[model samples]
Target: MTAHTATTLRSAGSTGISLPEAIRRADLGDAVALLASAKKYTVARLSGGRLSVPGKGSFADGAGVAGTSTERALPLSTSGPDAVFEARIFNKDAELRWLHEGDGLGTAVVLSESPDICRPLGEFLDPLYAVEQIDNRYLLWGRPLRSHDSGASTGPLSTGPLSTGPLWVRLAEARIGLLDVPVSRAPRENECVFLRTVEYVTTEPEHGNAYVAEERLVELFLAPPEQSKAAGSPQPDRLPEATR
Candidate 1:
């Protein structure tokens, strides 16, 4: 029999709290079971902007950073009667490593920053899985999409090799632009791939200088088409966020 270990899901706050305990106290095992039934996990914020899990841990300092507010600590929020959680996945190293959610299975949510998280989680979950790192170099075949303002046009931002450094300069000269979104290159067709949508927040009052608090709502999706589907045609998955 495959041994099933109870994965600990903790809360975010200055005082560390146990999410699983709270869930038990609130009698929310049914809700948690419902979430797990999807074969997917979700991260969301609860009262006091504290991170709540179906099982262990409570809302407390997620990253152990001093003076960070609860709002800044957890970015994902719950919705409706079921309190479905939501968050935006951005590109960040630390947040990706610590806060993002993933199943022990060979699947995980790809947050915004550092596409490396996909590989890292993949390796952590399935040692036998081969991870191939791909530079963010692709075309934005449609309009830009923003999490806050869906109507606002951020323009087609380039990703991959076209948005980086010396390569960026050459790509810019060649008509390519900076990359806005980064995507993974593995988990071919029919495979379930996890994609995280993290929303970053900061205790700092200034919008420009605040730091990223936490990542929430690690999402899952089907892997895109293979090279055969890329015969001079843009893959739908490769389209701009708006189009997607």
Candidate 2:
């Protein structure tokens, strides 16, 4: 996408919001950021469910089940042929096991050093916002794209099998490194990754509705959960941030 086109999409409908900007502000230095409290990552998706305060338009729950989550990360790098690392972060509900229902959601985007990498995802950031279904991850945008990869317009990214495993990219660690550690397998929407720490976060909705705009109440403690025996402070300094 050209600079002109990039600017075009941001101005499309919703103010100047674009995926890159959202990722920029995600606080984690990734596409997503959770407000920190105590020793836990406050993982919140833009809730499809909204908390309607009488006259309020409908504010979606920004935070999900807090201390009950585990994070697996891999940094984004490698510029030459593969700048775009594509994959799906899939999870199902604790009780409801339906795919494409969007029970799973999250993205912590660490900005890459390459403009090439950011540009591709930029093309569809607007559509991502306009999408009616709040939880749907981008299978491909409805738009035809002329990608930098082939100079040919391709459809949305091939829907890789809902990652039964965790997330992406590569290079020798000489100057490259994986984000955190690639997750071995995806935790079911509400399963615990560690047997000892049963406080894994659930992507499942606090309430059931086919789409977002309904508010789901995720429980979060001012402190870590009683079940967590693991120890560490989720201090802001401990989390990664964009190079900028």
lDDT of each: 0.26, 0.21
Candidate 2 ranges with C-alpha deviation above 4 Å: 1-32, 37-41, 45-110, 119-244
lDDT of 2 at 70: 35
- Against the true structure, whose TM-score is highest? 1
lDDT of 1 by residue, 28-96 (tens): 111101122122333332333244332222112221111112222322223333332222222223122
Q: What TM-score against the true fold does each predicted structure earn? A: 0.22, 0.17
lDDT of 2 by residue, 164-218 (tens): 3222101012232211212233222212211111121122357633222221111
Which consecutive 10 residues in model 2 have the weakest lDDT in total? 1-10
Please state the error at residue 226 of candidate 2 in Å: 23
Best by lDDT: 1
